[model samples]
Target chain A: MVPDDDTQTADERWLCAVLQRQGLEVEPARLAELARAQALLARYTEFLRQASPVSVRHLGQPHDA
Target chain B: MMPEADGDTPGLAQAARALRAGSLSSLELTRHCLARIAELDPGLNAFVTLTEERALAAARQADEELRAGHRRGPLHGIPLGLKDVIDLAGVPTSGQSSQLHGHVPMRNAAAVDRLEQAGAVLMGKLTTHEFAFGPPRWGPPGPPARNPWHAAHFAGGSSSGAAVAVASGMLLGALGSDSAGSVRSPAALCGVAGFKPTRARIDLRGSLPLAPSLDCLGPLARSVEDCALLYRALAQPGEDFWRADELPWGEIRGLKIGVVRSFLDERSGTSAPTRTAIGDAIATFEALGCEVRDVSLPAPWEWNAAGMVILLGEAFAYHEHWLRSRPQHYGAGLRDALLLGATLSAADYCRAQEHRQALSSNLDALLEDVDLLLCPIQASAAPPLDQLTTWGFLEKPSYGIAFNLSDNPALSVCCGFGPQGLPLALQLVGRRNDEITPLRAGHAYEQACEWHRRRPPL
Candidate 1:
């Protein structure tokens, strides 16, 4: 659950907006947990972005479409 | 009809031999499994559905065929289970989710068709994490499969029931789908042998997909030979498919084995027992005439990051519609996981794919030098169920996911027991499209060690 004060993270605030934009209404009880999951993915994606440009051969794979 | 085989549950190969010898009938074997399931499943929760009548009928037909000199193959008369995500015609393939509770597929999965063609009796649908994404938890239709090693501990996810059933002697062999370590993880924790063949080696049709690029179907069994037998039946023929005679078996001497020591580093959170078990495994390989050396790959967390991004993104793409239409239908753990995918962009997913190619290339290059890469499958023994969290992987790098990212054939075999008496496993990875090396190495390792001989206290 989201804390009442002082502990709300930027990830929590950003995720709230992202969910709202996607029309996903997360229960207040789960907002903090979802925010944590979002943050983890964000960290992972950020790590991947800094790695390298995607090769053309990879983009041609079946699921890449 | 022959009397039921007394003593412990026979491995798939042993059962096949007994059946062909006329000392054990398929009906007797099926009844043995049925009786065990009836007596044990209430506590293990390994099976979500039981097709006792169908199994009996199939077993009888197998017996008639054997008696008529129509032996199909090694799988003939063997009883096996399918992870709930794999379809068995006319049976509900729940994928262990509330949404798919009544969802029964009209046709058998390709693997199921092959198993049936090989004369294997289908015991029933085994439990799986919800849609193969949720953590091990009790929700929706039923509780998660309890680890046979320690009832209070988890049986590992996604393929939870497959490993539990195999470990508990409820099934001789079972098929479990893996995308990012599902099969190996469960098999490790449950102390069974599991083989994840190269990507798409087995036809994915009729099995639910967790990630199209990463998805693989594999076998879990009491021994590597049993796993190999099941693999031979399920895997589609390809340019690189292994012929029955091609398996190294006792010919694994002089093989080059690479130990990924970096995976055992403190950063990976590898427990001391797991590390010592892996060290002993290395020593055993050396004693068996394998040329072992230390090797390193890109950080495990790096591969894990790439794998997880692709997994979460692809899974979200598949579940988005249902998630939007009826979020309540999902377990909170899986629902939360799928929602994390929404945070990723197409760029993120594609970039991970690109990173995947680089990681695969690195592994391929390393395999050119080493015949097999040995590592720890799990960082530690199975944790108590109450200690598990949905996003626990975020905190610890999964040792098995790197192989999934690289599309390698990886085998998980029980190596030793931890201090808690729970099983610890070591992983052996082979080159892409080459499952024989890992299976051969695993089989040889089993012959050299007595770990696989120990059964769960259950």
Candidate 2:
């Protein structure tokens, strides 16, 4: 569960890429971890796209009163 | 009246007693709690919204009623915090998500309505994880709630702020929802008492859903007695199958207790101090004349997997539209979790559902001869703040989750502290609808031990 050193570095790089894509000026070192985090997110989302269903339960009910 | 440590600050029981004796007015107690929240909450991040105007007005009304000789009960005029996921009229029930930040409600959730009817003043809304599924990430719509013991450690979640508010004495008692270990984890880490009642014991009519099948509402407080009191107020008239106050204590004098040794001992990363504390707790039970027997049930991971499938499927069902539309509004941790939920198919969900029934039946058979089951609440003491991650909930058996899968009641109380002075806890679970036995067991232990009497150095 604890992200390893190389994985942490990759996550940092991913965050940098996201920032660059967003057109925000940033230091690569400053957002390195955030970059890897975004990449991990992309992986999970892709997993959902292939694994999840179109609908489940209580779909029409309002969650909040 | 007892002189206040800071000023007029009393534990929940003492506050109830003072209110009954007319020695303390509701307005005075409400003002004191408000002042405490103002002074401490900035450092703790326990509260998301402070209802000063409504709370003060309610307290004044309670005082007038008391002066006119009409009184409610223990909770009358008492100030309490509601976790943000629970609804309150005219307040935003954000579920700790940016997607629903401005969404307000027209009426209170059923649990809140019951508490308010019992005369408990609503002080504010407490923080929760993003939609009650992920770990804390600092750069949110607001800061993640910090542990009162040490600001550098986590307070556990997704009931993060409920535990902090009660632990710091900002609120005597607060409501928290547990889907996996949300309530118990935070309570254990923050050094307090948390009760996850039987799933059907309290209605989930108006609260935000994490996993409908596993979600439960309960209380986190300074003592088992306070949790019991809150349980009494929230328990439905004919629904709750167990009553702690009505249970005969002497009946448990020679009851047999099942010790799931492998579950507690097999895990890595468990600290020596936690092991010693758990060992001491078992010895205490043996010394109290109870029969302790070793028992084995289903593999812990089986239950973990079953819980994940059901939880993810249910949560994704709730958030699919939002995920499809405003995905970027969610924090990275939550966004990934919902994506995981999104991946579960109907067959996966149904298989998990069928597995849940089998699991519950298996657990029931295991509990046939044992009066209670005992285990450790967490793998280790609270981790440092920066080390918290999205996979934290998936890394262990979550001594509390299997019971949730089985819809059984579980209670967590401080057993002892680790070498670093962080709290360690023991979990006691009772049969379905039989919450009283565990509560009584906890109360007996609390009376004999010093753990509940100690507070964090903060």
Candidate 3:
């Protein structure tokens, strides 16, 4: 599933702004970094959405052993 | 003076003295420590892997170097433990996750290399929470590391084993990372001195990430001076930030201390004993010539919410691949807790980042007039091991994370004992990259107060 376009764009802009403020000479390179970070975040968000309803106890323990 | 028979009274100063005077060889010290671990660790579960063979070999090398007049300074020949997340070459740098159980690194983390170069013997890999994000839960591939003060109580995570090992004398000191109170919380509960140096003071290379922006590697020891010794070694040599030599201790006569009473004094469900102990510590600080004034925090919830959003976003980025490929390998609490990060929209994360910038600005302004800020490390002492809930993180006012957001140095110094007789501590926060001032103040206070002289009856 694709992340909401508006939210991703906003995140990218915010990250670029932060980098610029930190005086890191942000430009297109900073935008690329933001894009990569956001993509990773988006992927994980989706993974959470698809995860089964597993209890905290059942996550690590053997069930049918 | 003779060394204090009570382990608590003999701080790191005594240990260093013993090493320097040839009263204790590093090899003998290592054997004594291994024996302690074999005896007490069965009850405490402080180590995930005890490197007995490596420890002995390193100890032998340390002894040879000392005899050859090749001293490495105060931490020379000292034995220390690395939290499982800090990679030591050839050891499994498990994030305590089953998914990464067999994961080993080809090189030591920067901090570990620094410690080794300082002549510190690596005792073993200590336990941590799954990815350094969750509490210790029972029924694991291993037992939960328990508090040394009370075997049944929790050793706060995700630096759980590191704190326990240091407090129990199984190791002289240990390395721990702090993202959101992971270092100080456990150090506070376990009656040890834990330092969270200013962000980036020590290199994070080869260390596992909880939040890349916030994680800091520091030492957990029995005294502030020991923490300072380890900090000086781990920090990049010649870096201006690790300037402990310039700090003048016992000169706190004109220091301005911000009490930070709003969040600290707020009725955040802290136990009465903890409240009383903190009250006494403030009075003690006042008596020691510090100018104490109440300071306001940037609305407690705002700081926490901002930290939570950023932390989750960052942590999820690291765990995403594994969460997809092997969802069942993570522990229950950690999986659910990390899942919350998954639900954070990009907008939410950005808003959190914006809030973080504002909070950092506000906190810096608040500290402009004060040399240091003081608060309770945790709201209370160690809770029972079995009583901690899945959502325990949401329930407390995290005094440690506020500094993490500001990228400042924060230390946990054991102040006194709570009602249950477990250790109670106060958080000392300094300006960005200014660890010297806090270390000096903490060292001076430790000298004046008898608190650091007391040890848990293990």
Candidate 4:
């Protein structure tokens, strides 16, 4: 379910700003869809940050291994 | 003479024998495939291009070469379809998107070049999700490929058409790109065999990029032996390539198999039939004289989280330009998926990468004790096509993600049927660059079962 504008979370707000700054348009009808994506991204990214915080060197490798 | 239209289509192995025995001609086989496509593709939407004249010309050439006793290899004169995401010279590699409606490459993808060099007949291009990013959307290029087992169900993507074509007898085998389970999911759902080789084992030149970090080209076919044949032909030249022939066929005894049942849970919505199917497959492996034991991996949600972050980040890198300039051309599902990538921070992507490296290490440690890892490719049988949503994968952990994250060779083969009669699949994962073990294991299982012999009612 899409949160109304007044109920937008910080990530949703950030996502809106990112798209606007990049000059990318999200159709009004798709706001609910985009909000759902934002919620998923937030859930997963938080899990990554908290799960086994491995120190990674950002070497320019194409893939994980 | 052509095989009966409604009868079982000969697999590549059978076709090769018939061709060599002078009992079946390449033209006859190609014509039969073309006829099958003409009859069934209307409902399946499996092909984006037919290439009838070109396929016929190539079949005749293969016949002439064979008559002169100059066989190229096992694939010579066999019919194969390419997922449209992989380029075929002068033919539009649409990737099922309007943005590339008129774009045609002048060179075949490196794998395509290799297949042709082996004298394989090019049947045409198969369907894929738009840019291979998300669920198929209703759009200009064509309807999504429907499951051969039941048209109302999902075929699984983004390699939907490749699996559907092979399962329905429209093509004996086909090439597909796997990034985040694209090839295996469809193959599992369509009740065929799909193999995703270790990353970088096959040259990626000339194929459209999804997440280059995760993208690998693989084959979908009716049986494990057919997948092995195609993999041998597509893999880059190396010691690994030659070692493929050394696979001890029917000798999987004494092999150690690790079962990862934690990959599914109530949250993943695994069906009872799927669980039973996998349980039965484990028993079959044990009866074949293999040692089976339960093992654990990092939680599926943890691996799933890291995979999605990296996949979205890398995919957005490839698609940012198109997503920005021609946003109108993309289907809403693809657009939404690509946009999600924009919302990710560099920190998030880096963390995901860290998780990937750590997970790879964990998997490597696990593999040191086992010959192969086993799991279910899907939690259940193919769901109704209408039930699929672009964001649904995020909620359910995927069985195919950990292999992609670790770059291991993973093969999905049919194990049994579900209560709904759709196919239930089991995945066999081998150590990186060691696809031979999984292929051998899958081949043994296929030989012991009747699942692959059953045809879809379509």
- Model 4: CAPRI class: medium
Tens digits of lDDT, candidate 4, A1-65: 23338766666666777888777777767876788877987899987777644435434544533
By descending DockQ, how would the candidates be arranged? Answer: 4, 1, 2, 3
Task: Tell how far residue B34 is off in model 4, in angstroms.
Answer: 0.4
Residue B226 in model 2: lDDT: 81
lDDT of each: 0.87, 0.77, 0.77, 0.88
Give the per-residue lDDT of model 2 (tens digit) for B86-183.
99999888777787779899999999998998888899899888887767866656677988888899888888899998888888899999998789
Question: Each predicted complex: what DockQ?
Answer: 0.58, 0.05, 0.02, 0.59
After best superposition, candidate 3 residue B178: deviation in angstroms? 0.6
Count of residue pairs whose backbone atoms collide, per candidate? 0, 11, 1, 0
Q: What are the candidates' C-alpha RMSDs? A: 3.7, 7.5, 11.9, 3.6
* TM-score of decoy 1: 0.94
Worst 10 residues of 3 chain B by lDDT: B1-10
The C-alpha TM-scores of every prediction are: 0.94, 0.85, 0.85, 0.95
The candidate that wins on DockQ is: 4
Q: What TM-score does prediction 4 earn?
A: 0.95
lDDT of 4 by residue, B1-458 (tens): 45544566789877877777777788889988998999999999999998999999999999999888888877888999999999999889998998887999999999999999999999999989999876787778988999999999999999999999999999999999998899999999999999999998889999999888889999999999889888988988767554432434768889999998687545556788888888899999999999999888887778789899999999888888988888889888888888889888898998898889999999999899999999888888999988886787688878888899999999999999887789989999999989889998999999999699889997
Is candidate 3 or 4 superior in TM-score? 4
